[model samples]
Target chain A: MKNKLLVATRKGLIVFQRDAVSKWKVIGAHFNGIPVSMVYEDPRDGNWWVSLDHGHWGIKLHKSNDKGKTWEEVEAPKYPEGTLVKEGVDATLRYIWAFAAPSSDGSNSLLIGTEPGGLFRLNIQTSESKLNQSLWNHPSRTDQWFGGGRDYPGIHSIVLDPRNDQHMYVGISVAGVFETQDGGNSWMPKNKGLKAEFLPNPDAEIGHDPHILLASSKQPDYMWQQNHCGIYRTENGGDQWIDVSDRDGEAYFGFALAMDDEYPERAWVAPAQSDEIRVPIDQKLCICRTEDGGKNWNTLNSGLPQSYAYDIIYRHCLINQQDELFFGTTTGNLFYSSDGGDHWEALHQFLPMVYCLTWAD
Target chain B: MPKVSFTKALKRFYPTLENKIYIKGDNISEILDGIEEKHPGIKDYIVEENGQLRKHVNIFCGEDPIDDRITLSDMVGEEDEVFIIQALSGG
Candidate 1:
């Protein structure tokens, strides 16, 4: 399994290296112009966290122990000093978006997902870097969360619980789906039966937006979500949720989700244009598989791009493993499908708006 | 000594921060404490964890904008330049 790929672009962090005759190389760009939102690598030691975002120095968390070659500036997820702001929200800790890599069981325990919406937890195996806020002041985060086109509200999907490393899971765009057995110390709102037409009470526990949250590393209670309004599932882990968006007439809102760490009834989504014109639904460019999880759906668009092709796909940019699924697009296009989505390839073209796609070893 | 400089949007987040930095201060808060003692956290992106002066960060000094942004003292000159700048948060 020697494919590296780490694409997290909006300007910076793009390392790709396939080679073994598959040929895909571009291991350079790292922090170049800086707006990376996610990039994690720490298979245990290769150390590299890098989740920066500086529309003007708002969030910065870097660390690269030889992988990106050199870097250090690590204490980044804030909110500890007086910390208590909920009336119209303003505690300021903008943008981290995601990072759930830790749990070799040695419990170096790192799990972040921030941006006006918080959930930090960093341990770093101990060298005096302890972070641990455990869902920050999360009593539904005051007056019940909200924000999706930015004004603060982010924690774009972070799932951990291969089998209960304290069992935690989070995905909050407008705030929905949150769980913690003990690791995060008290929290619950599994978003029961999830759906939020934009809310007037489309079943709300806390705002509901979740635009990507997949946890089923081979069915750890089966879960999958991609919701601004549709596409959801949760067999048990989340307690209750099951919209399973096939949309019947096709195009179920869409943000990007990928399960199948080894097929827990496989999954993958990529439909755009839920209206406000987000791109590629009727403009045609697809990748909508569901080998029985969401009750059948298959529209993997042969080699994709059937028409004018607008494309957006950005919720950590759709990643997969066992049969390799990878994705990238905001118009900078970089697709892949080593047999999981069934057949596709368009390695690179233009290359910049991807946002986040992972796969390290 | 006092040169200072910065703006290139503060190199996004201190991409080595070197637009010009001479050092040895004599005001402007000792040249921002000698450029934050040689760039360690770059004065929290131009001041305001409480140090104040981040009303969209301005500094200047050689031409004038540093109106004692919280006792910056404003005096410098070894061939003073200063500058700093901020306002340009996202296009």
Candidate 2:
């Protein structure tokens, strides 16, 4: 099991370690008092990368070669000059929403998803970054894709097929899902079965909001997403998506999702009350788990707040490494589960508003 | 030459950042370039990729705020004091 946890919070990047007694405690904190948008560990080289959102200074990227001991600021991805989100809006790096390292062994490249719906490929060795023109120049982006929560559409999820480095999928708010089978040279919209209730045509080819997207590492073809309207699953590499939301239960709307790597039939979601009310379901905090591919959902709330709770989990806040699961909330609460979603224990309740959570060796 | 000063908050990143220094430039844009040469990567915090002042960043030429945020065409007098500050914002 991973023994260290990295919590990217609104105030800083915090590190927690499991002690000899198996208790998690704060081990270190970096970028104090600065909003950390994302903390990513490059799986290929174990390098720590952090994205900072300086309200006045613009966005920045930093990397640590020696764990969290030292850090050096690197070039944050930049949208090319004259690139426009629309007719006159010059595109810029508003936010670094997602980071993915190439699955191919010893590759010195990283993929970044940003606001204004630009995907960047960064060469780590030379620190040179370029926007993926194919995705940026997609036909529907300029006219059809608009902002959801942010002022501009953002790419927040990048899932690379572990079996094939060339195949990948990106999740964009208000723009739906796009798949690239040839290393991002081109992309095709994969929202065949998604519903955009806000649009005049709910079954339009694009403009579906997928809050978070995940794929089972063991079964790469099986994918799942916690969408704005409901929950969905794809069994055949996103050829078609099946709506599996619990209509009568408290599992219809949420932003965070986690999938079992070895079991394609199992998944988990932290459901909010609804899209309009961004809080725990019924004022109770619980994690809904599905053992039979979303056919049924079990509410797991043991050791969690039972009533009057108002914690909301962000898309990247819920993560799992085998049976050990961890999630941090926007309310600054962090919880850990040793045995899947059967139970949870509050690790810390007073950190900064947690943005994302990840584990390190 | 105009003397350029920065917000103390920047010292966290550029520990060796001097509170103030004289830079040779005729306009805000050229002055920023001179600052970047002295302290690498500091200019990005003040401006964006399009060379426009960040939304929440402000620059003052003596007691007057810079006029052209996009082109930064505001000229800096040789004896003027250029102050770069982070606008008070966010919770």
Candidate 3:
């Protein structure tokens, strides 16, 4: 089990360390009073990277080589000059949504997903970044893609196949999923079975909002996504997707999703009421788990708030390490579960509005 | 030469930032370049990659706000006091 947990919050990045007795406590806090959009631990080299959303200043990126003690700011990825979100609107870096290390074995490259739907590849050693032109120039982006909740479409999820780093998939708000085979030189839409009720054409080739996408590390071909309209799963490398949302329960709409690495048939989702009402179902907080590939969902609410709770989990908040799970909410509540989703315990309830959670060494 | 000052909020990131410094430039753009030379990477906080002033940043040339936000073409006098202030916003 990881001893340290990094909580990226609206106000700062909080580091929690597990003591000798297995009790987690606040170890340190960095970037206080600043919104940390994302905190990523590079698996390759243990470098801590944080993306900051300075409300007054522009977006900034920083990396820490000595855990959370000291940090060095790196040049944030910038959209190329003359790049347009549309015909007249110039593309700017609104937010840094996601970061992924392409290789876990001493690779110096990192992939970043940003708002305005630009994907950047950065060299950590050189502090140089280049925008992936293939995805940016996708023709459907101009006509079919638009924002879901934000003002502009954003790339929130980047999943690289464990077997092949070059084969990757990115999830974009209001733009469905796109897959690349030859290291991002080209991409193709992978939303064959997704449904977008908000769009005029429900079966359009693009414009599907996948709130979060997760691919199993054990079986990369199996993927799961908590979509805006419903929950979906792909068993054959995204050749087609299957709608597995719980029609009779509250699993149809939500953002956070966690999948079992060894068992693709098992997954978890923190379900909200619906799109219009972004609260827990029936004012009760429960985590729904599926053991048989979304055929049935079990509501796990042993130690969770059952009434009058209004905590919402962001897409990057819910994560799992084997049977242990951790999640942070927008209401500044953090919870931990030692035995999957069957039970949970509040770790902290007074941190900043938690944006993302990741386990580190 | 114009004396350029920054909002104290910036000291959180760039702690060594002086209260004010003299820079040699004839316009806001050139002044920003001179400031960047003195304190590396400080200019990005005020302006964007396209050289447009960030939406929430304001640059004042003496008594008036800079007119040209894109190119920052507002001229600066030798004795001008250039102020880079973060706009009042956010919760």
Candidate 4:
């Protein structure tokens, strides 16, 4: 028997297979160009969707039906009636940063997040020529950006309820979070406690832009947000949020956050560009875990070095299987923990920036 | 005046765009020129440097393909709908 670990990386996509003995081997490379975002395998089937944009390949939609064996491309996706799409000045690259698949809601759907925070949806899995509709296309969003630029709120993260796919939310680079209750029909702002530190006021009702987001059916309201200012969570489903880290006594800005596959509330996260350089700036890497929900958190830096370690991690660069939580540091360190957050092991010393970590069993 | 509509996916960057009039052209060239009269630079995105349809760009008549030989004049009509899709290409 064998299992696979699928990853979308800067070097392209690679599938790592685990044999009967659990020895990992590089099974395949699906694309050569830069695959900025991708899905390993959908629970529905081996159907995979990858978004890549590297050097004139522009932005692309790649599909694999046979467990990363072969691939197909959908040049254009079908849209609903009256859904008029504007053209881009720069046709060189249309970046698709994130994608969300169907959840346990029994509603089979897909959400693609692109640069400039353009949101589109595939309501049903009919055919390549029939993917339809815009989940949330704010008419005045482009003009309402906080910093007032194109790079604002590109929608890098689309978080779906593992239990109910219809109930979902997305985090924008600068605009913040938007939630949708009816699958992909419409959306509304769910940023109550969010605080965009970059704004003129840090305690404002609006503008706590989110860069990355993670959601689990078990913790529906407890989605994690890796923001430009700091790490936050919405315990009431984007209504109110709280800071997961208290850096007053410890370093806390974060970009990477991972939750347990089996238990959504249990999570592990790391610090990165978020640190304002005043949070102790400890190079000794640390992984913080929260078991009883985000009520409390503790650092699991036992097997880790005693000092001098700082390698920021990306939002999707971490994963957890049961109690085995793993995180990849920009320092090229892949750390693994078995006792939740108490003990740890450095799986391999070097592996690029270690952009992502995933497992199959 | 009969007009052609662009999809929301296309309207993203070009927000000012909605439904455009078909400049009195019988052939694909004339129709594009007509569109250019109303909106400039859009024909450039639809056509190519050599005037060939860009590989990723496709124009459809109902559900049929529209190309140089079978220009808009042959396929497009007041009764028929035209859809121009710029392939949303990605990984």
Candidate 5:
């Protein structure tokens, strides 16, 4: 089994091989100074897929069959040529925030979520990417959806139902959660209970900002989201949502969210001060855990920075796989916990600002 | 023939992208073309689809930066050294 953590950072990619529960050795940094938004390792072939976003040039996708040793550019998602470009709307891919291949089934199809708020499905058989025009051209998107700090709307989280690959969920900043039941042919907004206080209409169809979205790996009906306003949970497959943020509301405004596979009710989040501040609350960094389905939240800060910790945790930087939770901070600190979210230990510090983290199981 | 060398930073992508590569070309364009032919995906990093050098990439022929980036028609001799440098950008 491959026991490694692939950490995508602002300037490059770092692979950490686990030596023990507390020991992780840096394998090396790949793509040196290039920005790598996310890295996903193909399980069947043991190949690697990386989403590279150049600050000035644009976005590209690369595939490395021999792990990270060598890479070759592959077909990336692009808008159909001759498309119109507007001030707020985008016609082409600007950055790749998320990439997910369907779970189970040997199909070589890939789902890519990009900035400017677009979702695309690439069928390897045809070797062509088809934009989900339904979501892009949705009537409510143009007027309702707003930009985040990037100043262009984007899909930041993608979750494919492990039990049913056909059911997919995507989280778009300043837009909210979108679900596609009939593959990518159609989409619908699933933000019934989430809130976006910034918008004039608090319950608008679109324009809700969901920082991170996760579907329970074991329970197809369970879903969780850490949003711009607060954290939410849905037990009825997104038909409706409930605000289950910590009652005390210390770090309620955070981007990172993680769900435990063994216990569907157990989850984790790292809250920042607020949308404007974008730092740990009170200058202390901590991981908030919910054991009773968000009824109450407990702060976990044993091994984390306590004071003057002005780091922001990106959505994809916090990951939980096989009962192991990993944390990647914007300040380049990495931590891991084996005993749920109660205790943690530092794995590495002083790496590049982390953009994404995924475990190679 | 002008010899080509890539910045050390590029070795992270391809360990084989060593410094100081020997290629046979009379101009900067052909020299890069030859290098891409030898090293498959390096050209995409250095040049755009419009055939212009990438914004972050700069090519220096001997002691001077290549002035004509579009055509890459800058003259090169048998003993000239071509350097591909990654331009410093925002922090």
Candidate 6:
């Protein structure tokens, strides 16, 4: 029996399976300098999708039909330069930060969140069709999204309604959530209650830096995010958001959130470095859980150190493996949750800022 | 001479570089040059294009980060060691 785990490494996609205890068997590795953002294996199809840095390998996908035996690379949809953007600005898609599994309304597709903020779709064509992308580019919106990390929208996390795939939501760093009820043809900002930590007291800017944003396949509407200043949740399709920060005696706001696959309401998050002033809030470098959605929160620091970790965590980097929740902190510490986010233990000592973690068979 | 060593990250790429040899050099320059002549890419990765030690790359003469990043001309007598490591990032 091979226990496998998919790591979305800075290098390409690496499939790490244990031949036995304490031994790792990685296959079809990609590490020649291509930074991979997220890698997820579908339970139904037993396939792999690896998202790479935009400028390097945009919306790249890799699949393995054979039950974890050998893997194949997906031929991504390539758009010739000068087709979309005008001449100038040496732009190379440099980052793809997040990925989400598609739902029933589509071709069991894959959602890719890219740098400079944009959404992309991957094709799950058929048995004969090799792993490749059919749709490469989708604008963030029709009227140009208000404010992203920069001039354009850069996506960090994408979520789909478990029941209907057409209903989708995505989070753009330094901005807000965008929803598309019509299967991504057009989009609009879904953020109504969300707040931008970096936003000036006035309204000079319209966006905030997103540390981490997660939308579980199970509970698409129940989303979580750790932003530049606080942690928040929105149950009504980003129409209304709640500030779950500990600053006001409410549950401590976190930057890293891990939503369960089957249990959407139950999610995990961790206290991250916030603002230049205060000591790291709820900053145990520990992952906490909210059992009844984001209404309440608790700290799960058993077997975990109480010392304040220095690095800020990106929300999508947190994940759940079985009942266990896992996250990579800024200090290069990888924590795993066995009984949800209640108890965590260090798994890997250090790796280059673990951008994302995903489970496999 | 005091024995210096590379961290686990360094050992991964160069497994042969274990606690095998120890020598004293008059200066850090001579010591690193001697190492590069043996391990080609190691020095380049540790030292930057401007000939400065990369932030992630570190060295110690027993709890000291080699006094200076540039002036490696300090003499290392019969009891100095150099330790290198991967850049540490995150909280």
Q: TM per model?
A: 0.35, 0.99, 0.98, 0.69, 0.82, 0.64
List fnat per candidate, in order: 0.10, 0.83, 0.70, 0.00, 0.07, 0.00
- The DockQ assigned to candidate 4 is 0.04
The candidate scoring highest on DockQ is 2
User: Model 1: per-residue lDDT, tens digit, A98-202?
Assistant: 877656566466778786777777766542323345566676666678678887777887788866667778888888888888877777889988878777888
Interface DockQ of each model: 0.05, 0.88, 0.81, 0.04, 0.14, 0.02
Error of 5 at A289 (Å): 0.4
Q: Write down the lDDT that model 1 would get.
A: 0.76
**Candidate 4 local accuracy as lDDT?**
0.60
Docking tier of model 4: it is incorrect
Which digits, one per residue and each the tens of the lDDT, describe model 3 over residues A1-361?
Answer: 7889999999999999999999989999999899999999988879899999999899999999889789999999999899988878889899999999998435778999999899999987788889999999998989898998889899999999989889999999979999999999999999989999998899998999999999998899999999998999999989999999997887889999999999988999999999999999998998989998899999999899999999999999999888889989989999999898899999999988999998899
| Sort by DockQ, top down from the best | 2, 3, 5, 1, 4, 6
lDDT by residue for model 4 (B1-91), tens: 3345565554533557775434454455666677767665566456532344555766666677675532344535655566666666643
Steric overlap count per candidate: 0, 0, 0, 34, 0, 21
Native-referenced Cα lDDT, model 2: 0.92
The Cα RMSD in angstroms, rounded to one decimal, for candidate 5 relative to the true structure is 4.6
Q: lDDT of candidate 5?
A: 0.82
Estimate the Cα RMSD of every predicted model relative to the unseen true structure: 18.6, 0.9, 1.1, 10.4, 4.6, 12.1
The window of 10 residues in a row where model 1 chain A has the poorest summed lDDT is: A125-134
Which residue pairs does candidate 2 place in steric collision? Answer: none
Better of 1 and 3 by TM-score: 3
Those runs of model 3 whose alpha carbons end farther than 4 Å from true positions after fitting are none
Please give the lDDT score at residue A359 for candidate 6.
73
Deviating ranges (above 4 Å) for candidate 6: A1-3, A11-34, A53-61, A67-71, A77-92, A105-109, A124-152, A200-220, A248-254, A261-265, A277-284, B1-91
lDDT of each: 0.76, 0.92, 0.92, 0.60, 0.82, 0.58
